[model samples]
Target: MQNDLFPTDAESERLRYEPFHESVEILDLYEHHRSGEMDVVMRPLGENPHATPKATMDELQSAKEAWESGERATYTISSKSDGEFVGVAEQWLEWDKRRASFGMWIREPFWGRGCSSERAGTMSYVAFEWLDLDLVSVGHDPENEQSRRAIEKYVDAYCGQHDAVLRNWLPSNDFGDPTGVHVYSILQEQWRENVTTAEIATIRVGA
Candidate 1:
């Protein structure tokens, strides 16, 4: 099912992001998932802390299927400089409302390097410019101050509004139990007004 609501590929000055496909190296993804540094990221998704090689392969396959089925837009983030796997970014589409929610987890090595903001800017470009969506939303576990800070920076840059904290909105632990999430959203109009042409130029959507 090809969905016009998602972009096949996109990139920024520092990162290249695209749907899961054959070129993605499973071993690399598995190594990253199995690393102790990724425990924090995995916990929020209720993923296995001790992810086996098979588990990583299965998850990558699942993401590829989801993208093909138009159920989600999942991108593997990589460095443009050396093509190193940086992390993953995803967008959950709500076609009826012309809205999509963003989610991402970066490798610990890439943290504090503006990768999150760059990825957000590129995805927002896809949502508004390519997908023609009305709004792009993102939320993070309340206790995740790192994510909170990263999200807030781009949300503010896009002239987005901070929505309320929705209680029990996300999985917080390995148990899959729910937790509160701080939500934010950027409307198409707001994106049009705040994201400059130069900034938009930095994101190449058809990459």
Candidate 2:
């Protein structure tokens, strides 16, 4: 599920997406988890924000196992600028349907730099173009405006019917109680017509 797309020269030489390797340090995952920036992701999944390092490592080890078994693909979003682990992008695959769900979260310090947008765009290409998958979809907590805006660039249309209120879906935070989420998706043909042309141009210039 890994590819040769890392160390990209397109936007920033220091920023690239690479697959999650077993050798990756557990401290990195623990640090990101404890940063308090990931609550946007954790709160929605009802996960503990104060997870122990061992627990974090175990989770990453499981992800690595899943990748090896072709059940999932996860990438470490890195920054060469300071050699830091900025965030992650994951695609959950369903081979029978030839479809995947794409998700990503960037650290707060990296926000407003278009990092999420570009990486999400690249992975969308990886899913629909490189992997030849039929569809890629993503869901977000309705209150996560950052996620909503980041995902809007990839999907074809919104699914109002599929978007429903799941009571107590998101874990309570300082802001408020749990909230409902919305879903959006893009089909392969829609990506070819709507996004490929521009993405290919950008990748070519940078590749």
Candidate number of the best TM-score: 1
lDDT (Cα, tens digit) per residue for candidate 1, span 1-207: 465556677889889887865457778677776677788667665565546878778877888777777667889899999998888899888889999899888877899999999999888888887778999999887878888899999999988999999998665556757678889999999999998888877888873
Q: 90, model 2: CA deviation in Å?
A: 0.4
The positional error of residue 144 in candidate 1, measured at the CA in angstroms, is 0.7
On residues 21-90, what C-alpha lDDT tens digit does candidate 2 reach at each position?
A: 5435888777767887777656544455646888887778777777777777777777756767777778
- Residue 108, candidate 1: alpha-carbon lDDT: 75
> TM-score for each prediction?
0.91, 0.74
CA lDDT, every model vs. true structure: 0.82, 0.65
Question: How high is the lDDT of residue 30 in model 2?
Answer: 74
User: Residue-pair clashes per candidate, as listed?
Assistant: 0, 0
Candidate achieving the largest lDDT: 1
